[model samples]
Every structure is written in structure tokens, then in C-alpha cells.
Target: MYEDFASTLAATMWTDFDETPEREGPTAEITDIDSFVIDGNFPWTIITLETDQGVTGIGEAYPSPGVHEIVTDYLRPVLVGENPLDVERLYNLMRESLSGRGSQWGVGTIAISGVEIALWDAAGKILDQPIYQLLGGKTRDEVRVYADCHAGEAMVSSAEEGQEETTYEPEAYARAARLAVEDGFDAVKFDLDVPSGRDIDTLSRHFDPPEIEHKRSVVEAVTEEVGDDAEVAVDLHWNFSPETAERLCEAIEPYDLAWVEDPLPPENTDAMRELKRSTNVTLLTGENRYGRHGFRDLIEEQAVDFLAPDVPKTGGIAETKKIADMAEAYYQALIPHNIGSPVATVATAHVGATVPNFVALEYHAREVPWWDDLVARDDPLIQNGRLTVPDGPGLGIELDWDVVDEHRKTRS
Candidate 1:
């Protein structure tokens, strides 16, 4: 009896050790596209791709006007009957289709981002792997997150009366950074490029001495308040002309920013290349850029210190990774531009984990108190300025239907 029991135990050990779960092959066709417009301060255009095999995938595109129309009117017809697992092929086909409208840069790309992201989610689910696993596995267990703290009053509707207003004064900025630090975040970003203490014109590129001083003081206060506890970065929102941008970059150099983001608009790569040559300070941009092709010149020209692709805005998971791959070849850091809810944050993190030259990912949902509550997870999605890549299948977390049902917007 003892011999038989030992033999059985040994067999069980061998069975457990010798085999692992394998992903299912592509077999299901995409059946339908269901979407929602979660309108609040900013709209979240969420898409759900359904497969015939009872599997579904969730994805998000960055907030923009008329994304709903773009998705339903253009992309749905292309995706409905295709093999849900043919992610990259579908991505290319969509690009081809949109060539008539415009090249991959604006609302068309944003619409494709949502659809392509859903394909990855569907692929992950069909393969029984996390999105990161499908992307050739991750280099790290967690992706570092930076809080995108804003200074201006949020464009909240009158319905959101309970929501708080945020300001951009030196003291207020300091306090906001401290709050982020206390909440287990090691990095914080603030928008320092607002019409404050100055009036401006596009005809002439100039900033007043007091306005420049006010911006300088804002950075000083934040850096001082955070001290050695957390790193600081600031956004200029592509608000300045090249000449004015260089002056601002020089003025803010002493604060040791993680980056000074998008000082000039992304209209010209030659201009960005010139700006990079002028600053030893880490300059980052690319949230407005489309696919890998769109970012090619920026990387090849050594235009910026770091690349900041908004994964959901750029071209979804696969294209964003392709952009990072190019940036890695040039030895640059990738700080993904994130302004959506948890869906985009986690999707971007999956890509961040796979990239060799990733720096940090942005987290801009700080203003929405109930942002974390939208998804069902055992623990908080972000802690101590990093998010542990989820281990489950697909995006690894499901949208809480109850939460989405409460805040969904109705179109007239």
C-alpha cells in the first residue's frame, strides 16, 4: 500500500510539471461591434468586439469629438466578418481603406486604434494569454506609471457639480505633487503651459518676463516640494513657437524634469530636430503622431530625447510596439501619453512591458475619483507609481458593467 501511494504521488508530480496551458488557435470570426460613449468631463469611446465563439474583447480610443461616428460609420463594415485573430492584417486593411479619407493621423487613426486594440484583446482571449504574452512576453513584471496631474480647472459639465476644481499656482502645484507622492506615486506631471500671467498671439512668438517667471516659479515650487521623494515632469502642450519653446526649455533646466513635454506643436519634424539640438534637457513628444511610419522621421532625425506615443491614440497595441522598437534602436526612452481610463492605461502597460527602451507610462485619471472603480480587479491597478501586468487571459480585467451602465451617454 505504501509503495502504491508513493508511485501515485510521483505520477501526479510528473503530470503537473510536464504540461502547461496552451493557447487556442484562431477559429472564430468577429461577429459584431458594440460600443459606448461614456461622457463625463471627457468622453471615453469604448468598443467591444464580439466573436462567434462567445468570446468578447474590450478596447478604448482616446477622447475626441465624433469618434463614435468614425467607428460605426467606417470601421464596423470592415471588421464585422473578418477573422478576429488577424489583427495586423486587419490593421493594414483599415489603413488602406482610410487612405481615401486621410493618411493615418487624425480621427481615422483614433477610430482604428479602438478597433485594433479590440483585435488584440480578442486575440489574447482566443489564445488564452494576456495581451503582453501575445506581444512576445514582457521584459518586466510591472510598468512604471507617472501621474498626469493637471493645473487648470477641469472642463466639467454643470451636472458634475460635486467634482473639484484644480488650479495652477505655485503652492497649488506643490500641494498636488505632494498628494500624488503620498498616494504611492513616485512620479508626477503637471501642465505648466497655460495662459497665466500673460496674453499671447500666434502672429508673433513671445512670452512676457512675468509669465516666464511665473512658469519658472511653478516648476521650482513643485521640484522643491517633491524633493528627492519623487521625479517631476511638466507639459507645455505644444503651446509655444520654436523660439519661445527654446527659452522655456532653458529656463526650466535647473529643476531636472523627467521631461519637458511638447514645447512646440508636432507640425514640423525639422523644427523639433532643431529644438532637440538646443537642449540637453530631456525633450519628449509624439502623442499626436500616428503609426510607426509617422514616428520614423522623429526617431531617425534624433528629434527628441524620448518618444511619447499614446498607444490608444497612435495605432493601438501592435503599432505602438513597432514605434517603440524603432525608438529602442536609437536608444531612446518611451513615455506613453495616457489620458483615458484604466482600459488604455493597462493596454499601454502591456506594450510598455514588451519594449526594451521603455521609461514610464502616463496616468491621467487622477481627476476622476471613481476611475479605478470602473474595472473589477483584486487590488488597485496602480500602486507606488507602477502597475503589475495582469496575468490572466486577454486584457486580464473585465469592465464592470454596472459602473459603465451608470455613466453612459445617450445620443439624440
Candidate 2:
């Protein structure tokens, strides 16, 4: 099925190089390619590359419409005849091709992310090694995973095991926290900004008094409910001003929350730094950051205590590792924001295995019942709320084609 699809987009991507005898040697030329946009928690654009040697590597770009065109129209022509094992060389092409045109963020990074990851996957297979070995080696047998359980989604609030619905009361948060705790997760994150009805309305400079109290209740409920069983974190999603964020951070300081994520939008690091100074709460940020260059200042200034780059969105394996390494130098942890499918999750895990500063990878699809079915595995991919880094090869997971086709979005 993949071969047939690859044959169509790949016919021209694979330029016949019989004329260029000097350019020969160990080239695992790309033979076929296909991309899928599956509608899940977010629109996930997944890419697959088939080599002349019958090795098909899977990769994913963070959700973007331009990724399809970039992969097919821009990158295919340059990458088809190139050696898949020349991971660094191919990655340079992905970057330099758009150098003068600015390929650091948006569609540029997303496109490069897909191509760069596929190159690494192919390189791992050709070397007969796990992706982690290719990156360096394992730092841990399993990567700790944190569940993003919140009341904004269907959850277990009552005795009925399968019951699920969105409710944002303090008790609702407590129920969600208990649900995550019972499932063997020792670390949990909750969306604290949305529960207060006044948040979106009072966007100017500060939160109303009632709003502050409501937000505090949500945090305390989750922390009190989970107690010592699990460490708790809250995500602001950049919905607060520095003044408001400062107050909120001070309010939640006594609860012992793991960190306050993106209390304000990252447009101004100075403001974020001020927020950092204002609170005792650890700051975790940069899920929307694109590449290593985008993270340099964040790491250099020590604006945040943890860097959470979404794997697929933050330039895939190499770039994310670079960002993680940068954060490590500043004694910051790289937790990695993730809302992607199994492919991206495991790809991030291989990275999690290598980075010394890796804290825990996020598992955000607790509500998607078919999330596990997307991968071909006999046992569960996630065990006790942690993902055991697979030694198989590449990302160490295969997409369940039947399941993907069913949820695939028609546009891409």
C-alpha cells in the first residue's frame, strides 16, 4: 500500500543519477513518499519516506497546512536522490535551502522537522541501531511521562468507571487529579487558567479578586487531592499579564506546584523574567518555540527553569536535543510539550533517552480511546503512566494503517 502511494509522489523526487558517476557511494536514495493529516486532538501531519532498499521511515511535522507542499514541492526534488544515511548533510539542505528566506519558524521548521526526522530514522535503520544509539546512547531505560489531566475534558468524576465530561470546578479538578493518580502517574499537569470564568474577560493587566480565588481553589484542590502520591503542575497557556501572573504565582506558591508554564506569552522575555523574579514558582515555557536559535535567549537569560519544546514543532530530534543541551547548561530541565501521536511521542523518547537534563515527556491524549491503536503493538505503549523507550529501531513504532485511514483528514 505504501509503495503504491510512494510511487506516485516519488517518481520525480527520485531523479535518475546514472549521469553523475562522481556523486556515488553508499547512497540510500529516497524512492517513495506519502503524508497523512489525521484529525485527532489536533490535526497531525505524519510523513513517510521509502528508500530504494525497501526501508520506510516514519516522521511527523507539527500540524501545519504548508508542510504538505513543502515536503512534496520544495524538499522532494532536493532530497530524493540524496543519501538518507547522510543525515547531517540532508538536514543542512533543509535548513540552507530556506536560509536567505527565513526558515526558522512556521511552515519552514515544520517542513524541515518532517524531513530531518525521516533522515534520522533511516540512518538508524541502516546502521542497525536504535535512534537513541545514533543520537548517543540511553540515559534511562524508560522516560518518565507526565499526564496532562484536566477538568476541561471528559473525566472520571463519579463511581461509574467509563464516565467522562468536561467540568471546571475545584472538585472537578480534584476528581481529575485522583483519576490520574489512580492510573499510576506520579506526575500530573492541570490547565489552571481556564477554570476561572473571569480570565478571558479580564485580559488587560490583572485578574479580579474572585478570579484569583477561583484559580487558587483549582490548584489547591488538585494538589490536596493527589497529596504526596504525585507531583502536580499547572499550565497558564500564556493567558495572564505580568501583574496578574505575579499575583497568581504568589498565590499558588504555598501549594508546592511543580511549575507555572508560560504565565505570559513569550513575546517579551523581559516581562517573563520579571514574572520569574516575582514568584518562587518554577517557570516552564517555550512549547511554541521553533528551533535552537529561538531558544538561545531563553536559555541564556535563564528566564525559565524548564524548557518544554514540542518535539515535532521544535525542529524534531536534532534541534530539540540541541535545545535540551542548551537548557542543561543552565541547569534547566527539558520536559517537551507533546500533543502528537505515537510516532512523535516515541521519537521524543529516543531524545529523552539521550539528554541528561530530560525531566519527563508529556502524554496529552488521555481522552482519545484509539490513541494506543494507532501503533502496532501487542502490549500497551504506555505502562504505569511512563513510556518504556523501545529498543526496536528508529522510532520503534509502526503506524496502524487501518486506524490512521479511518481518522485521516480529507484535505491533506
Candidate 3:
């Protein structure tokens, strides 16, 4: 079945290339391709495939510009003529070939994510089953999802910023958080930062003042309205001084946050370990991270209670699962980061299916209304705050190619 689908996909992509010759080129072409933006206007590259079996799959290359080029110019040749159903082998080939290119981070991993997801999507079509079926079957019918209202258009630029910085008022966040629970989500996440200073002493207050107080107030409001049944997580965004992380954790302890994410920068395992020592609240890390090795040092140091690597950033599905498994051994839960498109959410769901230690997955739904237009799906993989992994083959969603071309952004 995959054989037919691969042939079909190859032929269709060729037709797409021929019809839209301007869109074809090596990954380098991506350098010339325009950046594709939507809703929150986060730039992304959409990896699409039209299978011979009359099915299509979509994947995402996110958080970076020019990632499509990485997929097209850097990884396409290896992938174009290959079996889309051979998801694991194809992923390994890319990993081995691009080992030197921050194999588990940045553009390289993001590119791999696109290809891997495309393959998964293709396979699902081939087998007439969802991607999760290929990953040791689903452990649960519905994967739990958390509403991520931390910062939507507030932090990112939907339109160009003017002279002054945007003020994301506390009430705006509180409103977003409260609405998330009202919208039937069981959990919500918000953004917090470590304090910054002109000098070292001022650093102690990095997580202080307006940001801290404002954030705390937001969490408290949401927690109060939603009560104990609801969960809340704080994304520190890795701006913390270790001392500040510990201090902030103490301050937010009463809220009973589901976890405090990325208390320290990804590189400082020692700082994370130290912060964990004094804090009893749950610690989360790994979204700004990479492969199993990215978590190895942190795991070895016993730094966190939850490992939240984005599959796209951590060498795609398989690699992120490997990291999740490692975390499981250490009694840690794997709550993946899903700030990208629906394609990424599906890819991450496949991994969450196989990992027993899985907790909840992030769904930045506030912007979903805008981003959903990018995909062609009858029913969202998620419903009623739980993602129901499509039982159909490969990431199980189709791409509206017209949308990609419409939103394309070129930089080079």
C-alpha cells in the first residue's frame, strides 16, 4: 500500500513542482522563499505530500524562518525517492547524515520533523490507520490537552511592532486563562520570566516586580475561578537566575501549578538541579531542548519532574520518544510542547500514544482559529480538550497547498 502511495506522492509532488516551478528548488530555494505567516503570524514551513493512494499528510517546520529550505534543499533528495512508510529508517538516515547540524535542535531538527511527519502522514494513508497505530498502538483513546494562554499575539508579532514595546496587560492574560477553563480545558499555561538586571545583584529580582507580580496575579485569578480541579503551568521561558527560579517557585507554590517550566536556561543543568533541591513544586524543562542527550544531563542531575521537549525540536518523533522513555525511567512525565501547527500536534500525539509516562500536551488554541485554515481536516485530532489520534494512517491530515503558497514569505 505504501508503495502505491509513495509513487502517487512522488508523482503529485512532481506535478506540483512542474505547475509551480517557482516553488521548486533545493533547500536553498527556501532561502529565497517568503516566510509563511498566519494568525499569531508565527513563521512556518508546511511539508506536504499527496500520496498515490489518494491521501495526503502535513507536517510543520516551526519557530524558524527558512526551514522549508532545510527540508527541501537539505533533506528532500534523501526523502523524495524513499518510502514514506519507512518512518523510522528515514528519520535515522536524516539524523545520521545531519548529525553535525545540531541534530536535535534548530533548523536541522525542525526540517527532520517536517519530513518525518510527512512520512507518518503518508503511512497512515497507506495502512488506512492513524500514525499512532504505527507507534505500538494507542494507550488511551483520548490524549489530554492543556490550553496554553500564556502569551498569544502579545509576545509574537502578528503585525510589525511600532516604536514602543507591546504591553501584555495582566488582565489580558487573566482573561485568557479564565476563558481557557471556561472553554472546557482542564489546564492552562502562562508565561513568566526570570528577573534581569544591569548588574548581578539586580539579577536576583529578575523574576521580580511587574512581571512576577503581574504573572502571579494572573495565575491566582485563574486558579481561583477554576479551583483545584484545574491545572496551571508557568513557562519561565528560561530567563531565570537559579536563585530567582527557586524564589519564584516559592511565591507561586500556593497556586499548586501543574509545574513550573524551564526554570533555568536549557544549558545549565547544575542550576536546574540546584533549583530542584529547594523547590517542591513540579519542575518542567526541555522545550528549548533537543534529543535524548539534551535530557540526559538534566535527567542525570535529577533536575525536573516533567520533560517537555517539542518533537520537532528534539529530532522529530522517534528521538523525542527516546528522550521521553529516558525520562520515564527516572519517574518523570513527558508533557510535550505543541506551539506549532496541527501537524505538529498530531506528530507529538503519536509519541504520546506510545509513552506510558505521558502527562498532558500543550495546545496553543487561542490562535487555532487562524492556523486551522492551513490544514484540511474534517474533525480536529483534538475534541473536548482531548486529542483523539486519528486511527487512519500517517499524521492523518491533508494540506491545502494553496494555503502554503498564499502565506509564503521570502527572505533571501
Candidate 4:
């Protein structure tokens, strides 16, 4: 039965394979693509592509409004009936087809990213190879992960109407760091851009002296709490002005942070470069950016010490691997910014495993209890502070659809 399916698929999909030397083996045509929105800590957008050969591949898009529509309405037309095995070719096709419809950046690229990941996943399953192996093999067996403990249980997004206000005290930050360290993560991060009780003007994006001191105190507390047990990093969330960012960097420099992330907004690479010049603390950015073109200036201008491209947002696996390659040429490390489900996390890990410059992958769902339950695995995907790269075909993990349906949200 399997041989019959493969032969039928190849006959229908690879009529031109004999004419092209580079094309070989059986090909599976994508029959349908679907997406689901799970209401987890964040709205996790999961994608699946069905193939003619009875294979289905799963992927995750960076969560955003209208991602489901973008995937089904826009991208589905371009993907159905195409060869899923032609990963890069299909990726470029999607980009070129959406040229003016915001494919270069924003949610359009994000939707395409999810579909592209599905393509890779389907391709891997068809070829009976893991994604890392298809990406040229692994550099390490395990990928290091950093827990994004957002300012002592304070949600990165705004609090609910009836929820208690999140405290921005140093003690809270310290306790958060301690808990993460106790959980076996050797690297942890907290938000430094939280309410400092001394904000003169947040809309102006300026940090007054008192606010700077408050942020510095929080950093000191976390660093002191973790000590040698873990490396501490803080996120500025692109919330401050360049001058204020410089002051904040200067204040935290004494603690020897792993990296201070996104001090300034994503628009100005020149400002980021100047901020890098002004601070001794390691700077990390690129989560807001997309694709190699989006990250070109950051890499070429030497803007930051580390690049944190969100895999599901920045053109999926192949595109991110290309970005890492570009960053590698300039000696910058890849520490991907991930706020995704286990699907996106494991997909990003595949890229992390293959890249020579991968430093660590960000884990943002520590606060979500059912994060590990979303995947069908006996053991947790992440053990201690590291995730062992899966050697099984494709992503090496499957979604627990029962959990997904339980948490699934209605599309708006």
C-alpha cells in the first residue's frame, strides 16, 4: 500500500524529474494546508500540511492577528498542488508571490514562515531524514535554552482587568531568578523595562535617574541571587530612547549580564550601532526584524553582540539558517527569540542544532503549565537547561491534538 501511494504520487508530481538532474526520488504534492490557534500563554498558531503520500507535517507561526487567515486564504492557494519536497523553491515562490502584500516583513511573512516550516517538515518526512540532517547535519547533540522569566511573574503583556498589579521590586526579580536557577536552567532572563515607580515620561521613552537606578537594582538583585549558578540577562523590550538606553546599559554593566536585549526600537539600526558603541554590556536584538534582508543592516553594521531572530516569524527554518550563516561571517551568535509552542520551539532547535554559531534558544512559556503537554512525548522536550536535538525523521515530535483542541481558540 505504501509503495503504491509513493508510485502514484511520483507519477503525478514528478513528471519533470527525469529532465532535471538535481531532482531525484519520489515527490509528494501538497494536498491541503490548515492552521489552528491555541490559547496558551500566547496565541500559538500551529500549521499542518497534508500530502498525497499520506504524510502530514506540522509547523508553528509566530503568533499574530489574522495569521490563520493569511495561511489559509493567501498562502494556501500558492502551496496546494506544489511539491512539498522543493523547500527552498517553494519558500522563494511564496515570498515572490506576496511581494507587495507585506511578505518582506510583518504578519504576511510570518504566515509564509509557518507554511515554509510545514514544507520543510513534510520534505523531511518524505525523505526519511531529520530537519537538522537536511540542513547539513548537527553541530551539537543538545541546544542550550534560556528561560524568559518576565520580571518575577509579571506577564510581558499587560495584566488582566482584575489581576493584581505586578511588583517591580528587586526582591521579586531576585526570587524569579532563584526559582529558574533551581529548575536547572543555567541561563535566565528578566524584563528590566517594567514599571520602576520613577517614570517621568514613558511615552517619551526616556529613563529618568530614578528609573535607571531601579532597573539597575533589579539587575543586581538577579545577578547576585543566581551568582555562579546561572548567567543573567535582561530585556529592555525596545522601550527606551538611545540616550536612556545608554544610561541603562551603563547602570547594568557592573553585573556582567549575558546580554541586554532590544534597548531601542527596531526601526533605527544607526541608533542601535551608536548604542552598541556607547555600552560595554553585550547587546542583543533582531526579534522584531525579518529575513536575511531584514537583518542585513544589523549584521553588516555590527549593531549588536547577538542576533535573536524569531524562527517562525523570520522566514522559517531555511531563512533563519541563512541569517545565522550571515551572522557567523561577522562572528555574531544566534540566540533565537521564541514565544512559540513546542512545535516552533523544536523547529527552531533543529536550526539551532545545525548552526555553528548557535548560543542558546529562548524558552518563553515557563509560566504556562500545559506547555509540555502540547507535544506527544513521554518525557519533557526540555530537560534541565538543554533540549536534546531529536534524531527522528522530520521534527521528531508530534502534536497532542487532544490538548490542542482543549486549548484551541476560535479564529477572529
Write down the TM-score of every candidate: 0.89, 0.90, 0.80, 0.92
State residue 221's C-alpha deviation in candidate 3, in Å. Answer: 2.6
Q: Clash pairs of candidate 2?
A: 154-165
* Shift in Å, residue 406, candidate 1: 0.7
Cα lDDT tens digits, model 1, 1-412, are: 4334323433344332212224475577788886787764468889889999888988998887767776676566656667877787677766765665643788888888988888888888888999998899989999999888777664222113554434556877787788888888898888877756445664465676777888999999989999999999998888888888888888888889989899888879999999889887889999989889999999999999999999888999999999988988989889999888788888998998888899899987776777777888657899888899988888888888888888888876
* Model 1 lDDT at residue 40: 48
lDDT of 4 by residue, 175-257 (tens): 77777888889999888888766537788998678888888888888888889999999898989998899888888899999
lDDT string, candidate 3, 76-184, tens digits: 5545545456567667666655557645577787778766776666666666777777777878866899977756454333213351323355545556665676667
**Highest lDDT, which number?**
4
Q: How many backbone clashes does candidate 1 have?
A: 0
Q: How far in Å is the alpha carbon of 367 misplaced in model 3?
A: 3.2
Name the 10 consecutive residues with the lowest summed lDDT in model 3.
Answer: 25-34
lDDT of 2 by residue, 81-160 (tens): 76787776566666655554447887878878877787788777766788999888999989999998744654443213
For model 4, give the 10-residue run with minimal summed lDDT. Answer: 12-21
Clashes of each: 0, 1, 22, 0
Measured on C-alpha atoms, candidate 4 has an lDDT of: 0.86
Query: Which portions of model 3 miss their true places by more than 4 Å?
Result: 1-40, 49-57, 152-170, 194-214, 378-381, 401-412
For model 4, which pairs clash?
none
